[model samples]
Target: MNIRTAAVRILNSYHHQYFNYENKIAATSDGLKLSGKDRDFLYILVKGVILHRSYLDFVIEIAAQRSVKKFENTVLNLLRVGVFQYLILETPPHAFTNETVDAARQLKKPRAIGLINAVLRHLLLKDELKTRLAELPDNESLAIQFSHPQWMIDRWIEHFGIANTQIIADFNNSYQKIYFRHNPVKISWDDLSQILKDSGYTISVAIDSPILFFSTDTPGELIRSELFNKGFMSVQDISQSLAVRLLNPQPGEVIIDACAAPGGKTGMIAQLGGRESIVNAYDISPAKVQLLKNEAFRLGLDFVNYGVADARSGTFPMADKVLLDVPCSGTGVMARRADLRWNRTPQDLETLLVMQREILTNMVNAVKPGGVVIYSTCSIEPEENWQNIEWFLEANPDFTIESADNFVEAKWCDKNGAVQVLPHLHNETGGFAVRLQRR
Candidate 1:
């Protein structure tokens, strides 16, 4: 399939809010039988437009002499894809113009052909796509230049300061290297390293982390190999692995993984908790529970058990250690989930804050008096991390913050015994994990 058709299908799915953006893209690609290169280009076009929709529209309004809101959804998306290719990809001027026009005709958008051509002609004459967008105000510049929401940029500026916020914004706008953790229970790092190397994979060890990273090109080869099927390696961000490290599950200890889905942390718990340790994992989704069961079987985690259960609704069995990786705003993982910046809204943060409080309270209740509770989220929002911890501590005087520096690197832990991994500073997914002990 051509990039234009695939991008349009993805945009239609995204605009309708019918299904997940990335999942829809994968399904569309598979349905169209796209080649590897065409699939990559389709992803680039779709994500590039979504990631930079605001900025692209700002440029489009300048060239079209009208607000993009006035155009129909199909025309607007076509313009976005066309402008993204012409300006950002820097495709040959004439070739891109002709290709986009042909795409519109092929899609049976004859009524929009003249308007598309006129806009492209005007954009070519204006030549503003290459200009440095420096003249605008700080808020406007950050929004249009980086294609992020103004409210989010302002919040980051307040939290990280002006210069560092820009650095983080730029990082979120780019692709991050894929990180993987070698399953120590299945295979040692040295052994896995040699195996991957022999399989024509380029591998590098992460600094200050036991994790490994490799080129993204060979994922197809790795996914189909015995290493993945047998769970010799697990794909996760280094910051996420820190949660399992901080939990420090000991031999024969009982661990409860609340809200566990896809079972990365649950598997890590089984590995770290020793062969005799017991791990009970729970998720709200029945489908996710099945996935957890599959992961456990693949990794040979005999001690780990999983079921579908909601953490907020009922009491859970008391355990020596509990991990509550609660869902949050996902501000920390924008690099990998490119469309997240557009999907999130302030209202969603409000809903998540309520859910996080409930889940943390329940998990804390489930842990034994002296046992540890690890509260974590893949979010940089203070309301979801430190502030939530503060609220929990204030409400429950029996629990106190445990120094996380004992397990994670001192640099990743704050003075309050919380780990806040910033993407710009750490060059990984943004994350926050704090350990609490019930007195």
Candidate 2:
């Protein structure tokens, strides 16, 4: 399939997922057939529009002098894709407009093609688009400029101040890094590096951890490689790897990963703990539990056991350590998960706060006295990060905060003893983790 048609198909898939509450990644993977460069272009067009949807719509509103809702959904999404390409991708206006107009005809909206062409042309004729972006007010402009919900931006400003919020917005609007963890158990880092290099893959060290490696190869190619099939490498984000490092699981100890799914960290624990330690990994979803089991089997991490149970309600035997990697608003990793900025709302944050509190409380009880409980989330929001830790500390007198910097880098941790990995600061996906010891 051509890039434009593939983009449109993926955009329609995003529309269905957006309206029906579906997974955008799963939808894109299932719907699009383009591969390699074409697939990359399709991803750029589709995710760029979604990440900058409001911004693209704002440009259209400025050029067309009307609300975007006035157009049919297909036409609107087509316009969004066009505007994103022209304004953000900085594609040549004539080529972008004409190509979009041609693609618009595929939507069977022949009558709307002229409007799409005219509006995009008008935007093109305007001298340098950046000049127009400078004209709007602060909050309203940022809401559209960054394509983030206004309330989220406001909340970030309240917690992080104006400059940091803008930095965060910039981070969220950009493409994210792809990091892979080499399984030292199956193959040494030197061997993995040689294999990836020989396979025409470029490697870089973005973090201090030797297990983590950054690559230029697409995730699809990496997953299908012999190394991946033989369980020598696994796709994981650096922020998550950092969390596992902070957990500091030791050999011969028992660790319970309360929210383990797909089992990235479970494998990490088992690998790091050598052959002596045991990991009882559980997730609320049985399907996800099965995925963890499969991952464990593939990685040859038999030390990592799996079960399906809700951490908030299920009772489990006490362990030397417990990892409560709870769900959150996922604001920190927006650069990778583009639709999350649109899908998350203020109410969702509030709901997640309650769930985080409940899960933390339950998981803390499962850890033995003097044992560690590492609470983690892929969220930059304080309400879900340090704020939740504060609440947990106040409620659970027996648990005291540990210096997260000691585990990772002291620079990432705040005075409250929790680490907040800001994407703008780290130049990677954002995440948060705080270690606590039971008194």
Candidate 3:
């Protein structure tokens, strides 16, 4: 499809969130043979639009002679995409306007093209929306100006204050640093750093741990190099490695990675605990199990055994240590998963709590009475992190809290035996973890 056609279809599919940020931009630009300028410009346009959506809607409300939301998704998103290019991205009116209008026409909605043109042209002339935003309260101003929801802004302001909230908001609208973990068994960071350097990617340390971030002028697929292929490295975040650290799989102990998939932690467990100890990684999906097994081999960790089993269902082998990095609301990963911000609701917490509690109760049984159950998530929400643990502690008399601060540095932990790593609060990605010992 043409550029304009794709723009219209993107909104229509309602799957734009998965593709919203930069994840799919490379493929999109490649498929379209987009010019370097146009590709960069569109990435800015699309991301800016999603990031500042609420603010843009307010602007549209003020600028349009009539309601803009009354229009079809295609026409509405076109206005957003178009207005985003002109206002935030500073993409020239001629290019952004002509392209968006052409996109509307390509969608077989020439009538909608006139509507898109009319709304954007109105925005260009009136200057009323910008003026109104300037006259509003601080949070309101940031909300409309930045296109974020007011409640979200208020929550951040309450927790982190205005300036840090803005910084975190701005950071979310940018590209994530691509990070990789060196397989401890096969290669050292010093050696892999040299290998990555020769391939045009510069690696930056995430922490004293094995993780490293890189920005590549060369494409990222270059990881197919000998170092990566030989199980010398795997991609992961700084805090992500911490959960495995907490599990501390000994050389001869039995460990289970509940909900392991794409097996970053499973292979890591295999790496640390050594291969012969039987790191049985379990997930409900067989395909996910295969992924765990694949990473095990790639990382040169042979002890990891893969099983398609659900933790909540309690249908797995017992173990000395259990790493339950359960499925979460995914709120902590807003920067990496843009669509998640809009997709999650407060009600999902109830459903998530049921699943979490069920899994915790059933899975803890698989842990030996004296062993540890390490509960973790790539999440910062208390309901999904601490509160659930509180409930679990109250119910499971045999379990006691083992403060995560005991193992990892207490620099970024909460007092209640859990850690909330916000994007603005830590150098690592947003996440939470807790260690519980069965009494």
Candidate 4:
């Protein structure tokens, strides 16, 4: 199979249909029976194109001396893949141009073959592209250079200032390292580390946490490893682990994971809280609940109870702690979810805010008096983080803010005691979490 051609088809499908990019890529790779290296290269091409799409379009427009809107979707995506290879992957100019032209032909876009060749060849003259890009205004330049939406850039600059916003954008554009959290219930961290090393993979343990490990190795290899299949470790971000840590589940405590789907946090709570803890995990989707159940079984955490129910209005038994990892615009995890940056819009934020608010208001009812509710999101937006907490507190006078400093370092916590993990500063995915104790 032509990897570039496959990548073009995937990109075209992604542009039209809103599906998880990782799952889409995996399904396509499996169907094609792609070799290891071929699969890796295909991933790099498709994800790299999506990651730097705006910047590629910028160069394409400059090189072709025309707006990309005028081109057909197939031709535009063909050019995007070509420009991404030449500029970002640093593929040989001759091979990049010729192979991309061939991909267009294979996809039955013979008419676009000449145009793809011309635009890709023009990108070889890097100076001209850079000169033209430099002529744009600062905001437009930042948006194009970082491949983020202009509105998002503007919002970040207003909230975090230009320097920090640029740092966030740069972090999002770069590839992220794979982080794994060892399941102590199944294996010791020391044993897992030695096993991974003996298997010829270089692994590094996080300084602050022994259970956390990270590697630059290919994620597919790690995921398919025997240790992973046995549930010795889970692929989770260090930032994500913070919310569960802040929850600090105790043995015999009844914990409710209100929005538990993939069950990373649910598994962590089970591991940390021990078999004595009763974990009732719930999500709106039955498919997600099934996935959560599968993950729990893999980790040997049968103590966790799984159910399909929405956090917005689900009935639940009162618990010592409730974790509402609410959905949001997902602005924080743009790097890990490559297509998210393009899929999210300002209007989506307003819709998510209402749902987040509803979930927070309803879930707190399940928390017993003096118990804690940890509201969290994989988002950096203030509206989705501290602002929601502020709104909840005003409406529910019985709840009070509890500092996250007790669970994490002071640096990760804001003045109001919320944990705000920034990708640029923390070197992990950005996220937010706050502990609210019902008085």
Whole-structure CA lDDT of model 4 = 0.87
Query: By TM-score, how accurate is candidate 2?
Result: 0.92
Lowest lDDT 10-residue stretch of candidate 2? 16-25
Q: Which candidate do you rate higher for lDDT, 1 or 3?
A: 1
Against the unseen true structure, what C-alpha lDDT does each candidate score? 0.82, 0.80, 0.73, 0.87
Q: Please count the clashing residue pairs in each candidate, in the order shown.
A: 0, 0, 4, 0
Superposed on all Cα atoms, model 1 deviates from the true structure by an RMSD in Å of: 2.5
How do the residues 302-356 of candidate 3 rate in per-residue lDDT, one tens digit apiece? Answer: 7567778878875777789999999987756667665566666667767888898
Query: Whose lDDT is greatest here?
Result: 4
Tens-digit per-residue lDDT, 1-439, candidate 4: 6788999888888754367777778888999999878887888888899989999888989889999999888889889988888888898998988898888879999988878778877887899877877898888889999999999999999998888889999999888887777788988777877888888887776643534656636667888678789998888887888898899999999999999978899998999899899999999999999999999989999888888898899888999999999988888888888889888889999999999999987888899988999999999999998888888889999988888999888878878788999876787789999998998
**Candidates by TM-score, descending order:** 4, 2, 1, 3
lDDT of 2 by residue, 143-215 (tens): 7778899999898888878888888999889877677777888887788788888888777865646356565
Residue pairs with colliding backbones in model 2 are none
RMSD of each: 2.5, 2.5, 3.8, 1.7
Candidate 4 displacement at residue 368 in angstroms: 1.1
TM-score of 3: 0.83
Question: For model 2, what is the alpha-carbon lDDT of residue 170?
Answer: 90
